[model samples]
Target: MKVFKVVCICTIYVLMIMGTRPTVSLFAHELGASINHIGLITSLFSIIPLLFAIPLGKKIDHLNSKITLLLGGYLGVLGIVLPGFFPNFLGLYLSQLIAGSAQTVLILSAQDYIGRISTKKNRNQYVSWFSFGVAVGTLAGPLFSGIIADLFSFQITFLILAGIGFISCIIIHLVPNEYPIKSKKSPIPTSKTKSTFVDLLKIPSLRLALLFSALILFAKDIYLTFFPLLGLQFGYSNSTIGLLLAINGIASVIIRFYLAPITNRFGTFNVFIGSMIISCVAYIALPFFPQIVIACIIAFILGIGLGIGQPLSISLTIDNAINGRVAEALGIRLTVNRLTQVITPAIFGILANLIGLIYIFLVSSTVIALGTGIAGHNKNNRKTDVMEDSRVKSI
Candidate 1:
């Protein structure tokens, strides 16, 4: 129940952040940002996370999550409100950097919080709840921001979202200073922290999980960065674009409610491969359909494909982590995730400029399908090697 409460409160905080996303991209476009400029601006949002995620995670391992949660919450409000006052490219850049830093703490802390509180038996359920809440926030964020931006202005949208973020900051105090399920293992020594990164990377399963996470986030970054531009090219209004984005969220939410049963029945790895295949097809299909209804259907399919990977990845990281160092392991996951977020848009932005935007979907989908195949083949090969080693020992 406490996990649910934390998830709910944190969901509000996430709503503020997700709400700002589309507003920032579309606003930058409106401000005459070239596709390259939009990509650069979007990349700025992850710079702090890419740089600081592991260090932040190491710090969080020793501290109460409440402190970091509050810190991130207040910082997020400041970042959201900054552009409201300045209303320019300079303002957007600064807002993203600060917001990125806030997200680095918020996300790591939230994941660590739920992880520490739940036993292995219910960890999946807790993560599902957290992911489910996040889906809600994301769905609501675009819908509300789109309408407000349409009816009012981007600046007005910023101020209102900031107000909502500020309220969530107050609500965070309701979360207890500590959870009942604290780890019994001693903390890692300060000297070993450096080696922890190396040690964690040595795990084959964790390494695979990290790769999957990076791939998933990379595809997501492509969607978030390019979809609005695609919608505008189709001559859709801001409200229409927002509705389309919301449809993606709707599909994600729908899939997550069934996530536990589905993963249990079919297995996470198989589900992951299936989802990527679905996502790859969705991306390839997306470019051809400009009709609103068909586009909405593609977006929904895309959402379901993307949605399942995140929670499964989170569960995998948590299950694989060394007992005392779960937060650090998650930090590594975020570091990998943020790396893709930082690189994908900038690279694709250049590509979009050179080859045209529609073809980007095809290009990206190919990469996704290829990466999935390579990773799957390697996993199977590893299993075969282990089986052969066992056979030799038995002989």
Candidate 2:
């Protein structure tokens, strides 16, 4: 129940952040920003997180997470309000960096809070719940922002988002301050072979989970970044573009409610691997459908395809982490996720200028499909181990 409460409060916080996510891209486009400029602004969102996620995770592990939560909340409000006050392209850039950095802390603390409260027995259920809440927030954010941005203006929409973020900050009080589920003491270091990040990289299961999750995120980034531009080219309104984005989120929420059953029937590896394959198809399909309805359909398929990997990644990360530092594992996981967030847009942005916008979706699909192959190999290995262990038990 405490996990539910934390997730509910976080859902509201995430709703504000997700709502604001598209506004930055759309607003910059409105201000005559080129694709490269937009990519720079978007990359700024993850730049700080890529740099600071590990240190921030360490901070959350040692300190009261509520303090971190509060800081993230207030900063979310400040970040939202900044662009409104300045009302320029430059303002949008500054707002994203500030907001993205704040969100990094906010999300990490919320996730760390979840790990602190969850038991191994019920960890998967709670992780799914957290992911479900993220889906809900993601669904609500773009639809609501789209309506407001269209009805009023981007500046007014941002100001309203600021007010909502502040209220979420207030809602943080609802979460109970519980103790860490894992030991808070740091592991004693050994001189013989210092465990480095490379050691973590050596884990086949972790490598599988991290790559699968990050590629899903990368595909979603492409959707969020370029889909609006694609829609606008067809003369769709801001509200329409928002709905297209929301369709993706809506599909994600729908799939997650049934994800447990889905995983049981298909196997976790199959679900993740299958999701990527579907996503690859959907991304390649997006460029051809200029019609809003068609685009929405593609978006829904895209959502369902890409959405499964996230919660599954969380579950797998917990199952696979060698150190039992779920907090640190999550931090490292996030660092990988943010790295994709930072890199893909930058590469695609430059490619858009060099080649064309349509080609980026092809590139996105290729990357996603590549991840599926690697995961498929891991999945086969996992099954073999399970079967062998069962044989040993029978003996």
lDDT leader: 1
For candidate 1, give the lDDT. Answer: 0.87
Q: Which predicted model would earn the best TM-score?
A: 1
Error of 1 at 265 (Å): 1.7
Which residue runs of candidate 2 sit more than 4 Å off their true CA positions?
Answer: 181-202, 322-324, 378-395
- Angstrom error at residue 133, model 2: 1.1
lDDT of 1 by residue, 172-243 (tens): 888887632444543334353445576677778888899789888988888888988988999988898889
What is the TM-score (0 to 1) of candidate 2?
0.92
Give residue 33's error in model 2 in angstroms.
Answer: 0.9
Worst 10 residues of 1 by lDDT: 179-188
Residue 257 error for model 1, in Å?
1.3
Model 1 steric clash total: 0
> Local error of candidate 1 at 124, Å?
0.6
Clashing pairs in 2: none
